[model samples]
Target: MTSGLQQKNSILILDFGSQYTQLIARRVRENKVYSTIVSHKITAEEIKKQAPKGLIFSGGPASVYDEKSPKCDKGIFKLGIPILGICYGQQLIAQYFGGKVRRTREREFGRQELFIDDHADFFSGLPGNITCWMSHGDYVSSLPKGFVSIAHTLSTPNAAFASRDRKVFGVQFHPEVVHTARGSEIISNFLYRICRCRPSWEMGAFIKDTVSHIRQLVGKDSVVCGLSGGVDSSVAAVLIHRAIGRQLRCIFVDNGLVRNREPEEIKTIFRANLHMNLDFVNAQNRFLKRLKGVTDPEVKRKTIGDEFIKVFEEEAKKIRRVKYLAQGTLYPDVIESVSATGSPSAKIKTHHNVGGLPEKMNLKLIEPLRELFKDEVRELAKQLGLPQEIIHRQPFPGPGLAIRIVGEVTPERLQVLRDADDIFVGEIRKAGLYNEVWQSFCVLLCIKSVGVMGDERTYENVIALRCVSSSDGMTADWVKLEPALLGKVSSRIINEVKGVNRVVYDISSKPPSTIEWE
Candidate 1:
């Protein structure tokens, strides 16, 4: 099934094309209720099939007054499931069922106080006058039939509304966003108290279930998995290898996208622990030779993606009777329908997906960790008794430093960036910021600037340090690193790394900027 979360206590998020729609899913998953995000244009027939425990309407960019605003049919309301709507979702619910949406010139674009009324099911254990993140242009002035107002802000009188009989709830402010104090608790209240879903969604059960399912699916057939030594693929390899034992063939592709000593380190871990049939394909020359002079980002992505598949295919031909190809794809890579910045088509870089193979490969797709987020995958890995070093490792792009280099993939540039990145990550660990950041890396910019290192003019490659704190990789804020820490990191990188003279910190958030530059 395309809906990967079918077997769990699911929360269905009918995406209203909101940037934070995925955030709603992340929040639900945090409550241990597996959630799926489907397009708002989905018919009621589709909603009926998923059989969600609860329904949530996500906020969108569209105003309720738009002639072509996104909305779901009223028939979904009658599904007898607990429904909670956010921002534009609240407006949609109110507009459809005898509520008035007024366009206010004053926009509540940031934090707002929620004065909670105790007479509702939504505010079970939450306190009154709590702050929530608000981002909307329109406000719901009137309530829908059988829906009474339970909470309000200074500007929004109908901030929250509910129907006692129907078990419907709506909130004008986004509880999914982090700026909202006690937002997670409110979301938890909806999932546990309101919908009453079972809390059986832990990692231990997931590992057991996935292992069982993999055993059933592959039987005794040989499966080839690409192990990039990143958490995703490494964890996937460990899980699948544990289930199938000798049947799983792991191909560690040293695409030269890896850091110095990475291939050696990966070989050590897999060989020592799993002891399965491991093949190391040194495709660095192939990848770097193909990526030479590729300046355009999309072109680089396509070239890398295409070349990766070809290498994988070539490697697959060597191993006889390998009928399945496994990848370490996660939920964020699949669940995200739109970028958080509300950009055009949400141009995705092809670091993770080697662009799903053509018909000729004839390999059945096996993604054991497809349904899980990265953290959950780590948890599953831990349950499967994988080493802690492999489990707690930070995320590196499938294309590795190639994407981080920004312009082209060259051996010279890669070496410099690799050293700098190593130093940066090493120093971060020394300062104890490794666990705090979801991802932190050094970007090797193509441009070089003049710098004075001990009274000598040196024009060298520039490195941009990016460290963002995020629960999920969905929405993120730049980590407020201390000046002394930054100074130490900069001094170490400039002195130790031969590639560059300059070190810059990225202070941009995810809306106008993504974690990765390319």
Candidate 2:
């Protein structure tokens, strides 16, 4: 039996520090097949125990030729499980099999025309000449024994290769990326045709399994969850309550940094609707006092995290016998919060939920949704019979608008930001563009500019509108709002948000700029 919750016929993806590893998992889930991302250091015994239908190696930033490149157990190949390697994963396989791989003088990092051949069924039903997205610097120079080229690019002749007899496949170009035309179909071929996996991964089954797992992990212990009215925490609280009814207690903290009327809405949804054991904490002054004059993003996160732990600990004292703390910590949060599997991509930001708690808190953590993504959480929330409002709310930081304020956090600044953000989001919903984008919010910049308000020279804060389209929070692109919508939002912000005179839109993408300005 698998030690973890890896179900039958699921695909196990080994992460080699790839930024797109989570994307690969997301693509697999989109096909209705379960996918789990494990560390590359997983042992052969572990793979055999998991008994997954197939395995996929995620493309990583590391070069396989390097001495410190990540690796996996070689003996798993003998397990006869079908394997698909992408980019660095392909190079790792080629090198292990005595194939030649050399760094090209010119790095390949963009779109290329990939020509298919009749050697393998991986490209079956796809066009002979297909467009692919390539982002690897190294290429396989020679084929391994019994492996034949299935596809070729102008620069990368061994763009794709497979050993049909051994049920092994490798693709130089990322088939998981949407930029690659028919990329999803190519992956489907490997999944259905080669691995013989059925669409067994569904939200209904996931909720059941998670409920059972939570009941077992937290037996007879009182579990306390910090419910923020967001889909993640709300879903988590509901899920846990189902598992251990009445044993779970949800705490809704009025941290003073949340949006206008957010606490009231959260109260209505969870306390009134769900009928769960809910505690409302008024720690507005506590949080505001600590956050005064804090400018550095990291320090601000730490300060909030520290304060959160202190508050939770105090709450637990009143609740009595609270032994577990359930958080809505998702996979992307864990990935971005720290170096995942010692990847080259180290800590991006310290998410308050993941890094907020003290090392030795009285209540242990039980993050039932820690391994899931935002979209998956929404799916589960919908299946759990949650309202559309909870399922489709924009992603809010654990630190709330504190990170969005971009400077010293104060009550005066917080109120101004709350008004502006509320207007931006309300208008987005009114325009019917709310569901079109992954996240849309307003960031209050500390800087001020002189402006003429009815012929009077006034200096006021600027609110930057950030709207991005993304499958997960991993990589995001700016949403190009129509000029009319922008004009409406800008005009409303300048006129309505009292302290704000200027409204600007953020057009930067994730790599160069994160979703949040801070």
Instruction: State every prediction's TM-score relative to the real structure.
Output: 0.91, 0.95
Off by over 4 Å in 2: 1-6, 339-345
Best candidate, lDDT: 2
Candidate 2 residue pairs that clash: none
Residue 359, candidate 1: alpha-carbon lDDT: 38
Q: Write the per-residue lDDT of candidate 2 for residues 242-271, one digit (tens) a residue.
A: 999999989988999898888898888887
Clashing pairs in 1: none
Residue 57 in candidate 1, Cα distance off native in Å: 1.8
lDDT by residue (tens digit), candidate 1, 225-332: 988887888888888887888888999888888887988898888887667678998888888888888988767766776777787778887877778888898767
Cα error, residue 251 of model 2, in Å, equals 0.5
User: All candidates' lDDT scores?
Assistant: 0.80, 0.87
